[model samples]
Target: MSKIGVEQSLTNVQDALRAKGYDIVELKQESDAQNVDCCVVTGLDSNVLGEQTTSIKGSVIEANGLTADEVCQQVEQKLRH
Candidate 1:
């Protein structure tokens, strides 16, 4: 079971990830990124999060302009270990 943390604003991403069986977690200021398998965000250079986005130890995925399906495909590829 891959644990995935997602930005709170991306409801479509969250639902898509959930449908794919990935555990979805809401991103918050104090959330522990080390505990998750991956962290999904709109972008690493997001003005909303600033420079604090890279705190996660696991793979960090930028949603960018990709659709939820595209995001899911990326995650699935990254999660293969």
Candidate 2:
């Protein structure tokens, strides 16, 4: 299973992903996302500083208006490629 970094506040998403056998890493600090295959954020502070930087090589999924199932589907789709 691929490793997934998720925001601490998103308990629902974490549980759902874990149920699907994904390795979920609770994102507490920036370093926690270091080796994750994908990251799920709340999108509350995405690009807030208007600065572009690459911290991880994997894709980032914004869990703003989507349900846990939808986010999981997106993760699966991204991993397929």
Best by lDDT: 2
Q: Summing lDDT over every window of 10 consecutive residues in candidate 2, give the lowest-scoring window.
A: 46-55
How do the residues 1-81 of candidate 1 rate in per-residue lDDT, one tens digit apiece?
A: 889988888899999999988899887643545578888888844643444554665787899899999999989988884
In angstroms, the error of model 1 at 51 is 6.0
**Tens digit of per-residue lDDT, candidate 2, span 1-81:** 999999888999999999999999998877778899999988998752234664887889999999999999999998998
Clashing residue pairs in all predictions, respectively, total 0, 0
**Which candidate wins on TM-score?**
2
**Per-model TM against the reference:** 0.82, 0.90
Candidate 1 regions with alpha-carbon error over 4 angstroms: 44-54
For model 2, which pairs clash?
none
